[model samples]
Target chain A: MAEREINIEDITKIEGHANLLIKIENDELKEVRLGVHEGKRFFEKFMVGRSYKKIPEMAGRICGICTVAHEIAAARAVENALSVKVPECVEMARNMMLISSHIQSHLLHLCFLALPDYVGKDNSLEMDVETLKKIYKVKEAANRMTEIIGGRAVHPCDVVVGGFSREIGREDAERYGKLIKEAMPILEEIASVFLTLDYPDIRRQNNFASLYGDEFSLYRGMIKTSKYVFEEGEYEKYIEERSIDYSNANRVFVRGEDFMVGALARLNFNEIDGRAKEMMNEHGIKFPSNNSCHMNIAQALEMVYFAEKAMEIADEFNGCSERGEVKNENGEGVAIIEAPRGLLLHHYVIEKGKVRYANIITPTAMNLESMERDLRWHVEKILNRDDEEIKKEAEKLIRAYDPCISCSVHVARVV
Target chain B: MKIGVFSLTCCEGCSVQFLNIESDILKLVEKFDIKNFRLIKERNEMPVDIAFVEGFPSNDEEVEKLSYIRENSKILVSMGACASNAGIPGMVNYAGKKAKGIKEYVDVDYFLYGCPFSIDELMELISCIFHGKEFRNKNQNVCSECYLRGVDCLLDKHILCMGGVARAGCNAVCPYNGHECSACRGGYEGIDIKSHARLLLSKGFSEEEIIDAYEMYMHEYVEELKKWLKER
Candidate 1:
């Protein structure tokens, strides 16, 4: 056997940092190693000695891509710590903010991150000028929605512990409603395009986890996996974190086995409603696919579902009798929201009206092991392929997860 | 050719920024062997030629990890604000007497400054290493590289900026963008807190408003600023 070594340092175009190492024998891949060199922020430690009221604001800094998830989870946690029951108006408003985030996040991921891989471009910037214009249109819609709700794309400061710092007036919601209504057709088109894209043929059967609801609904549900419905405080009972030597973030296993979250997981669970099911059926997507690569289609499908849900929620809030307000006190609480990626959990302990401790479990952390599993499967299956081909194939598998470690680490980047 | 990258206690944005570099990063991967990285896979244990360490030493485990990296690797680069002057995480030093035992925190060698170190800086640092160049500390403040084109200070307009007292390298992004500086880069060694506060007051800002702005934006140093105000 003849062995040759070629080093691949920083693999880009995906979220966070990663490196690829391919070892070949006779021009066939024998072993592949992915080295992700991203740093970890010990947010749990940072939460200590900080005022509980500020946890949501601080945690909101986690990731620009999924700031709403962080803010919502932190707010829920802090509210729980103080044992304060937030008003229904606040809940509805919070849900609206989350829905807005979902819309923008899914749009950004689908158009900017995941689509470029299928479109054979390095980044959205590399897309054909005409196609790039279309992508920008989608981005503009997402940006418009984000501004209407959270204030900006990166670190939105409007969300507070019990409620939002600023209320979206009837006029604001109406403006958002118009943008969301316009975005629906574009989302439908994107979903259709995703359905037509050429996806990898690799199939790996993995259990899925997500907040439960019908396809068209974004609010209200416990985390639903195939075998269990774990309520908010019961999250730890279902999902356990194991220490790993490679990454600072722990490898999460559901019920003593590896599971996936995000697009593939959401689709596999199939807890969505009739309308979403009809849409998926129309697109020829059969649920519980062993071929996780089809998760991108699921993501696109969810965007449509989420957009419709956002419109519904916005409409409902517009009809509500009361405005939103923040309730204060100290206690412990937990919240899990479905971010664009998957289930995002924020747990907090509050003392004297400040956050005592905070723990965040992002979808990417949950899918880390699953990502490695898919990578190994792809590498082994393509062991006979050329080194360059193997590298490209492996990268596609990683991107399929759309991992958001910045959310897991609870930080933001300008870019 | 093996590389090990680890983060202590700080925002992970610098690493994410590296990922944002895209194609240049892919080219770097085509050159070097990566033995261990936490953000990529679950496998661990490999010999490394270069160790990129981010974050500050917070506790015993972090200290142990930093020491391990220093002992094992031929080159150790402290790559972000946390690694340099403890960055934002080091702000725990201002949490009153309760945080006075910070020296008991962690041990480290080498320091890189920046709230989250810039990707361009990381690339340059790597280039300097490959070319056998010595590492040099950047002593400038964020205002030095700020893209503001030398507009009059916002502080001159009664807005508080840690830019004068904070270390540089963020290119003054916050202030240049019309937002007040948060001093996320950490404090400068020779900053005179008394005079800085007095300058803001002289600019027609109230003492309470100045303190509020500082505490709101740069919460980490609130205790020290309060102590300085008491003396004045």
Candidate 2:
């Protein structure tokens, strides 16, 4: 086992199918190919000839975990192409949906995907039932908040170009408001328990980027980092997306450099929400972190932060009114938003009310290259460790980044 | 009964919906051994009493995996529009190439339909499997459930709704939520596709609108959809 040519097929605790092939020849790391083991849905290819009205629904199908991410991003993109701007209230609700959906997504990552690793278990089910129940209860409240406003958790019906397809009533907003209030403390309790785990740490110079806002926000932002900033419309000037031969998904580079996106990236540049920041300070967690495992901590903090935000939006929502008027026209628009995972970009050109061109760069594809780079560094650093320890450490590292294989595989395979 | 939840090449929305079962999801782990649900946990290569697989076999690796899972389980429930009919991703076949589902590669005991089905319906199907009860799929149209729920028909408002011929088991949720029923569920038994299109056309909708609605789940049957739209 010492002279190992390890092929870790089907890396667990992530979405879609991804594997790693590591060739350690004479105990020297010779090759590390992070393979995307998925069937390319080629969403970009299929989006051609689709009506702008249909683009959000179809694009939203690209990933279930971040359906709202795709729906809102696509809707905003189409709305931009049509030069349509909904009333302030409609924008508020859209932002509310975007913000609340993160609560569901972050909890899903923390409770189901990453928690088991901290406990040295294969699955969360192996944990005691009471702990699972408490977490699910909190997660259920988050789901209710998303569904009450966004139509449903998986694929929101109200989210469409030109504003909400249906107005979420005042009663529905208040209902979710109460639901989230009751669950917030329980969420904090779970976060306290999770923070006690022995998190692995490594400081690296990985480039971190996210959507920018005055305070922590997911919608209506430009891409910002320590080195540079770019407007949503000027996304192309700063970023380049190209196919990599080893995977089904395309990788994004910020001027030929692999960077990170999602919560860790968002926190690196944006002003933290006051309540969320207070919670972080209480727990002794600070931002601009270089540790990859801190990504999970970032998600945990974001879960509570967004949960508080969801409560405020749900309480204040009067109802959706004065939605944007959609007209059939030809134009192009680009939208950059922070998904639960990281920065998600949706760009579209609509011709005569149909989507003529679409390019979606997901957080997973954006993080994949950076993740592999980190993987290589960790594997080389631990080459002297036993095979069992090596595999366990490898999985924990990959899971920390929370790569969504289906989201990444949505890109057309490059030949 | 031991259960396994497997997702292939779709959005994994059905899996998210399963998690949307919420706190009952904890009860689910207590009641049944979910040997391999990738979303909640890893270690997905084990045998089970009931296998719930979502999405289509979109590649050689998936086709091979589907065959292996079929061999490992006694009952395999194809768990969404993608598993049953390739869902929206079936649009990749608009070029006349075929989009393949789990059924194409192996035997499927039952289906829970939708772009993604509701949690109640999924639990009901799974409970039936656990109790050894005879299983049945809802055979009514979406309009039936909408009517039963006293929902306003979008058609009356000239909204070009597709509920008249869409499958009903989702309890007409899209319509209840003030949507026009884009027909995520495939058409129900004896669905009157021609008349539904004609009626929408009479209400000021275009032929293209009707075609686009069906494309959500029936994109693989694009030829038949256009044929049905044009007839009479």
Candidate 3:
């Protein structure tokens, strides 16, 4: 009978700081606002006087969990702006980095962060020792793959704009290939463990977006939406970011509507095959599943997909090739890659080899609208339930996106 | 011991690194009570024996929370470069007010300095604390590690590497792996920044390039380097 406002501060297990405010009155949802309060680092503005070559390194610091994703996106953007044709080896190296990145991030989300929720535990620390050890093995394998290719598990050093700074020898490739080969069954065991967990059943109709390619991709791909298609550089023309008073992150809209991006979105649009597809079918996960909680399952399945993909890439590896020199020019480029969370975009405008303007749109910002929609649906469904129950379910839905508020907030443009 | 892990403004990379040492952490947790860790725990309130605070306090809210943490803990350790030296998040401070580290607002018992803190050092620190042993600092520069590992000196190749000046203890992972040192760790104490700048300039690197390289990670100390250069 009275107005009820619920405010959640610093949601746990996600990458950054964000809060949710929901108001309801007389069984009708009044307003839902997702707020990001991470401190403002003016990354876009700081790169104004910097050379295009430094963009990826600077941008890579934007997120630690998705450093490889940001680095690749920034490098691709610079390469696109300069119209530089990267060597074939560079593309292969980048794909390796992406697959490795996805593996680590997905394992982090699925086993460490999201597992506690479905299994009735506080955190992975509370899980059984054997289960934790298996998860650790997956994380280790993922990190080893990154270290083999990118040179560091975190912010990789060898991956530059034109090509890599070092070489991945046959020994390095074979070592990680062995790790991936050993990781496949471990991943299947992890997937089987996740399949037993409880996933909340809630579906909402929303447009799904992902990079359309020949196969499930984290590297170069065409932009595909549910209905229309666009080029990577043409994102600004269709996707718009609007500032809100409640949060520093700008809520993004695709063609004036809230669309979804991330693992679930990828699953909805992309045709997945092999071990991952078989696992999904075994678990009865069909396409266009709007359940946000299924994102955890999607992440677990992605681990299988990326492990197989990484092994295939590693098996064909000969050695690193000569990197060509990059010729800078005055041009604009937009590069989009699928981060561990979802679609990540980095746009750069270069002038005389210097970055005149730069903008980055992280997946979390794009997911905020849909996350809020999910919260509203779930909260309203359980309005008559206990308040504690509603809050628990709401937080669970929000964490499913693996939102990175630190990546979402940039105050340089605002200032 | 009851431990708390807190974060503020920077990317939570250091926390991820802390968790990345998965099996070791599981063993460590058995020895100590993890009272509060927001990344892993839901309840963040407890009487903490030691608190490992990550990220820099870039706003008033962060400052208030950090102060509360300092008040509630017996010993507070600034973990990672952001907390101790305001790493990448503090780069914006170059154009504005200097970003304050944890020590700026509250007393810090120890400082574990690195862009993303080193896992080995973290393990050592934890072991020392649990055993009540004084943790000896590694005072050598990264170049020493590079020399020990037989990693080629980038200076000979005319590639600008920060190993000669940046602090050691990262085991020269970057250089040994074929990438020049980017100085994820802060500089060795009292290293000559002016000489390093001149060396880079003689190598045909532009002044901007030298300054940019030196100030990328630990920009908090760049002001001191500039002052020392001016005096010379």
Question: Individual DockQ of the candidates?
Answer: 0.09, 0.76, 0.63
Docking class of 1: incorrect
DockQ of 1: 0.09
Q: Report the C-alpha lDDT of model 3 over A1-415, residue by residue, as the tens digit.
A: 7878777888887778888887889878887778888778778877787877778777888888999999999999999998888877678778888888888888888876777777778787888888888888878888888888888887777777787777778788898889889878888898777766787776884687889877778887888887778889789888898887888788888988887888888887788778888887887878778777778877777778878888888888787766757765789999999998889999999998889988889898888888888787777777877666777888788888888888887433645
CA lDDT of every candidate: 0.63, 0.81, 0.81
Ranking by DockQ: 2, 3, 1
TM-score of every prediction relative to native: 0.69, 0.96, 0.96
Candidate 2 interface RMSD to the true structure: 1.4
Task: List model 2 lDDT by residue over B16-130, tens digit each.
Answer: 8887887777777778888888777767657898898998887777788899999999999998888988888887652254676778779889888887886777888878877
- Candidate 2: how large is its RMSD? 1.9
The reply for model 2, stretches above 4 Å from the true place, is A1-3, A413-415, B94-96, B228-231
lDDT of model 2, residue A372? 84
Q: Per-candidate interface C-alpha RMSD? A: 7.2, 1.4, 1.5
Q: Candidate 3 residues B1-232, lDDT tens each?
A: 8989898887788888888886787888888888888877776676799999999887788889999999899989898888987876566663356776788889998778776778888888888988889986577789999989998888788777877778898888888876678787888778877777777777788766666777777575577666765665
The TM-score, computed over Cα atoms with residue i paired to residue i, of candidate 1 is 0.69
C-alpha lDDT of candidate 2 relative to the true structure = 0.81
